[model samples]
Target chain A: MSFINYSSREINCKIVYYGPGLCGKTTNLQYVYRKTNPDQKGKLISLATETERTLFFDFLPLALGDIKGFKVRFHLYTVPGQVFYAASRKLILKGVDGVVFVADSQIERMEANMESLDDLKINLAEQGYDLDKLPYTVQFNKRDLPNVAPVENMNKLLNPRNIPCFEAVAVTGPGVFETLKNVAKQVLVELKKHY
Target chain B: MSGSDLVMYEEEFGKIDEELQRLYIQTNAKVVFLVDKNGQLIASAGETHDIDTTSLASLTAGNIAATGGIARLLGEKEFTILFHEGEKDNIHISLIGQRIILVVIFDSRSSLGLVRLRVKKVSEALTRIFNDIAAKSEREKSEGKIDESPFAEISDEDIDNLFR
Candidate 1:
């Protein structure tokens, strides 16, 4: 959901970074936080558990350039990727305007990637959103690893919908913002359609 | 809504800013901002003005959200007001006419009655502007232009370069 401030001429939207454990969702954010100009970003809030699993979520508020005359701001969030943290995932998805499914591309993790995508669909369905219909995209992360599934194979298996998919090594910052921008753009377009 | 109706670009900020300045002094509230439930800030006035108004705007909406949960537990259709008494300062949150949030941060001196009465009037004025903004946003979104932003054309290499 987005809020438009007639007083200041600004528009704000919420975007979520979602995926399974070790899929580089948090890494994607950390990379953005490091790269973003301090003036254009907010405090990167991470609520991780004692053992270091994301306890609740991570939040990063960013200012994209203005659209027309309205300032477009995005609040980026990432849910705990662990399967046991299902409840927290649902909470974070509330009012989500867009979703980035960061799929781990290492060959060994293909099962986790597929299962996580399935989980995302189920959770979204519970909240009245469908992965296929919603403004969503996929990033095949860990592309730098030799064990990584070929982008073609990953796309065929996970993103058959052809909803924009990207090749990325999130740890190295590849395809992070492109992924964000794609989903954000799609969300804005979807919002525009409704308007 | 045409650019002419934009109070920010057309209306003299001095007038509204001064109005907010006076309200801040009279109320002695630490933070005061008028925002729709959708989390858009209309006008902000208060002392201790160094706060991050942007995040404060969103955080105020979050507070309202948590309160929505509270209202559900109470078995009501919705909640109109919420008060939180902290150690040094107390927070008074009220829904102004069901459209905007009237938030007042004050210490002990300002009586509850005073805040309530002031909020009643502010809420009425805010509700109209907020409703207009909402309607306009609805119009824009329905037009489906958000997908056309240039940023959407970015590629994997562009995102990778961002990290540098």
Candidate 2:
């Protein structure tokens, strides 16, 4: 859901980064937080377990430059990617305006990616959001790893609909901003339809 | 993300802001803010000038989300209220109207009982206002009164300009 506060002249949207465990969802958010100017960003809160793994979710509020005088803010969130955290994932997707699926680009994690994608579909359906209709993108993350699967193969499996897809090395920040910008654009376009 | 849009006009915003201001004075809390289930800050009052309500709203929503998940696992429909006691300050979070979360932060000058008492009453009032706002938005949509031209006026160039 996009929040348009005419009183404050502000537009707020919720974008959730979702994928299997260790797919670099949180890393994508951390990179965005580090790169964003302090004045344009807020505190990044990670509700992680003792081992630094996300327990519930990681949230980062970012203020983009105004769009035609209305301040545009995107609240970025990452759900716990572990399979056991299915409940948490559903909760995080409650009012999401957009989604970025960070698929692990490794041969071993391909099955995890598929499971997580199925999980995403099921969860979104429960929330009355069709995965096919939502403003969504895919980032084949961990591209720097030598043992990663080919982009063509991953794309075929993860992105059958052929939505915007990017190769990302989230830790080193490659394709991170591109991914964020494209997702944010899609979200705004979606908002335009309703506004 | 569900297919729902949160529309807030100046009129409803004023009503909500006024209620929050009342709650702040009635409870003497450090700050009181309303956050949507999606983490958007709807309104805030009290001593929030120096605080980052944006971050506060996001974190509070996440907190409520986690707590709500716990409630579900325990076979509960939802956990309506959560109170976090800190050394210097405390936080009271109430999930009202199932779509809004009311958060109150205060220090030792106020007791939990008083804050909870005040919050219970305020939550009901807020719930009513939000209900009316939702209804009005739906009516606008049905009547084709929503101004969608602004969205049409937004070009790709305009979107690209923001990143640059």
Most accurate candidate by DockQ: 2
Q: What is the C-alpha lDDT profile of model 1 across A1-195, one tens digit per residue?
A: 565444566767778898889788888989989988997798777778877677767778887665656667788888889999776676676667788999998888889888888988888887677777778889988888888777888888898878788888888887987888788777766655443
Residues forming the 10-long window of minimal summed lDDT in candidate 1 chain B: B1-10
DockQ for all candidate structures vs. native: 0.14, 0.70
TM-score of chain A by itself in each prediction: 0.95, 0.99
Model 1 CA deviation exceeding 4 Å by range? A50-52, A83-88, A106-112, A122-130, A145-147, A188-195, B1-26, B35-42, B66-82, B95-101, B109-117, B132-164
| Cand. 2: chain B TM-score | 0.95
Error of 1 at A102 (Å): 1.6
Write model 1 residue lDDT over B1-164, tens digit each, in one string. 11111223224334445555665677766777765454445577866467666555556765675566567668976788888888888878887665567778888777667777777765655555546655654565468653663434544454333334
